[model samples]
Target: MTEDTLNSASIGAGALLSVLREGPARTRTELVELTGLARTTVSQRLDALLRHRWVVAADASTSSGGRPAATFAFNRAARLVLAADLGATHHRVAITDLGTTVLAERTADVPIDRGPESTLAWLAQTFTELLAESGYDLADVCGAGIGLPGPVEYLTGRPVNPPLMPGWDRFPVPEWLGERLGVPVLVDNDVNIMALGEHWGGHWGGHWAGYPEADQLIFVKIGTGIGCGIISDGRLHRGAQGAAGDIGHIRVAAADDEVVCHCGNTGCLEAFAGGAALAARITASGVLAKDSRDVVRLLGVGDPEVVHLVRQAGREIGDVLASIVNFFNPGAIVIGGDIAEAGEHLLAGVREVIYKRSLPLATRHLRIQASKLGDRAGVVGAAVMVIEHVLAPQAVDTTVTV
Candidate 1:
């Protein structure tokens, strides 16, 4: 079916499907109450969904009281989504059901510098293997979502002049992956998806709970690079050019530091506090750390130098973030990435600076801490991206017609 035909179809089915997918809708009466649809329209939409096995009937006895009305739930097994989290030094791929339940997942040390063609080819093969292991066929895939470690034009799913991702600038990621998987592909910056993952995983509770209340949040990833993801008014805030959270490139006011950034800038926040910077600092200090992971390992062994450097880096990051806090006034800030694994050292420095520098009003309600989902945030967020898009009202309408 053409896009025009799909859009022109009756929207009743989409509405019903969306409601049912969120949770079980017991009885036609309940669906009517929830969707505000007439009984006849509800019946028509239910029939269409049932015919396609997109929904299934639960035991009638499960319903409370009256004449045991039939209950229906979204058929999560009917389709799958492929989610990939591609970082600078590592990647993860997973196969998830329509409901975002991961069935199979694999992690590897694939570098993005291998370029899009090679990296995507590896992902394609890995996705096929993941599906096979999960006992699902490639035909069952409804869509795919990937998170790249750089700025991306969300609409086009293309990296835009990414500093660390050599040869990936303007790469047609969605087109390349979609053609290989034979499904719609969505892509976004890695940190953005990580924020989505953390938000969806209920990491924004306590200080505030759920959307809207927890909407004003910031996710800072201090890995090989430093970047942030902003959530405002219960939605991811990608700037007009999809660079809203490119905090790594922001110049810091540290007068004594003149470290050069990979983006060819001096004294940027990432140059002073990112994983690469820490690793380089450790190496230059006559330590044998190879990368950020090594620095973390040294920190684990109580190396005072590594500990001091990490804490200082945290302060540097927090110094930059203090301005962000004053500006955005986010309720929560989640810190993630390789260095975050060092635990309190990083958090202490960040908290110390943010609380001391930001205005009292902003700092009073702010809750800053380590990431809850940790390394899995990206993959889970990628899955969320696919699940959300595929289950949207318009997307469901198009799918039903197709």
Candidate 2:
């Protein structure tokens, strides 16, 4: 390694831990060489990590001859994270290792509008059940993350004036869950966590498997409402007030003025294209579609009118996303949620408008595709969010010091 390169590498225990997380194992000499730190300095950092069980020494040696050299690897199983994906109509909870691998998970139709106290009580109980099912306990949990289907004040982990989430305004989500779970809790919008899951956790393999690794990506969820999560330079961009991706409420150009939105807006994109809106349209057509899931089921049954409406809904969503594509110029846009599960018709409409309306430079390398993870995206993303926060450099340093 170059002297300048060696000089630039951080020599902290957290820095070393970050390298170890990249996989494989390294000996103390290799760690010194890679981190560009003195042998004694490397030993000190490694000792701290080993003491905290953040890194473990392999039993085998990596030596050609003479004294055996010990190897160290990041202990991905050192802690667990409890993650919950709470939608307006459904919720899911999971227990994952530090690596974001789901060890145990459960999903139910418990609605979010049940109010924070009741919903969170159910969540806390479910988390306990999942941990025990996974052979772990609250003590093994490092942190918890939740993705709500509404606006959230990310810094405080509280919902803020969410339209669909009645009785959840300014609710202390983190505090309520943390008090029960005995760990730090983090909360964010459902689509944001889906974006994180689409970006960080991928147990599903499909055509768009390659998109999650993109540094700049957009994840659009078209369920009861339409929203997006932006990934800029490989990190979630929550904007000021954690409301950056509330694309559904944006006024749609040339939208029907008569279409009313739950937020009391007349021309909002969600009023025209969201799942609830589509379901209402289906109901008007004499078909019974309770929600977005019903819309997908109707699409499965080849209901011609539902198909037409879903495609048109996709077009309306695309109309709004075209401007987003031009402005953000993301590397990829992943489509998810119940409406998206309606299949390729939505994607076709979206691709048609996006490719036609977006600037050439933006469209040149942009990929618009379906979410591989599908319904599991939210829960997986929730786990990933917790894993990143719990194992962050500052958190790691604090853990070692503590």
Candidate 3:
């Protein structure tokens, strides 16, 4: 029978699963009350969920009189999610449970420009190895999430004219990878997933926890290139064409016509402040640094010129963020990527500009700090993306039946 034919008392298995996913196991009576389903309907749906291993019997509920009622909880371990964070020069793959907890992970220096065929082939093989290593197989993985270091159309999961990723433009990432892994896949820009990782993972510079104001947050990644992931009202806001937080192209006061950006723009923020810019400047000064990682190493060795360059980049980035703070007024601005390794040197410059240029009210409770998740943010966020999608109520409704 069609779902529309069911009576109001015949609640779907997904609705019951959603309530249990909120934590704290509930008994049959509680599930009936919470979902407004008849006791028999709740019991039937709960039985189906139990048969599917989506829900499991937990400790019985305490009672003042008679025997305790059996309770059921969301079975987070019932399935797994494969997550991949592919960068310009590196890639990290992880296997996580339905709860987004990492079960196995692997990392390597795999370049994106190597083309999608080779890169994705390596990813597919690596996922197989990771699943085996974690004592699981393809059947256990519910879905996969990938974060590419370029512009990805959220609806199509295809890279559209990604400058760094030449061969990946408009490639069918989800369908291609999903075929290899035998599960559904989701893809998004790297910065967007990093933002999800930072915000959902709740790493606020240090061990700070229980941040109630996290509904509005921004994650800024200052690596070889600069970009931001916006969290508006507790959701990742991928704007029209999935380019909402492309702050790197924004023009800044410090930039001049002489500062040409790779995107064919003059005096853009990234031209003067991205890690590539600092590396270029340092190399031009006869430092022989190859990339952003080399620039960080120079900072570690107390290279005054490199230190000055990084701090200046931070200031340039902050100058752009100041306008964002005033306009968006996010609860926090999290700094991450390879450059964040420079520690206080980078943060000091960013804080200096944001606090000085932003409005008093905007900067009053603003938190500008380093990322606590560091390099792992991308992979963790990728897993979070898949977990949320596969376990969502609608998807669950299709997977489980009463």
Candidate 2 clash pair list? none
TM-scores of all predicted structures: 0.93, 0.94, 0.94
Which pairs, if any, clash in model 3? none
lDDT of 3 by residue, 1-402 (tens): 223333455457876676787648998877766666778888898998999999999999776677898999999898888899998887889998776677889999988999998999999999999988878899888888999988899999999988778878899998898888889889999999999998877842334466656678899988878899999988999999999898989998866898888878899887887888888999999898877899899999999998898898888988999999999998899998888898999999999999999999988888888987898899889988887787776777887776
Q: What CA root-mean-square deviation does each model show from the true structure?
A: 4.1, 2.6, 3.6
Model 2 lDDT tens row, 325-396: 989889889999988888799999999999989899999888888987888889889888887777777678
lDDT of 2 at 285: 99
Model 3 worst lDDT window (10 residues)? 1-10
The lDDT values for all models are 0.84, 0.86, 0.86
Query: Who is ahead in lDDT, 1 or 2?
Result: 2
Ranking by lDDT: 2, 3, 1
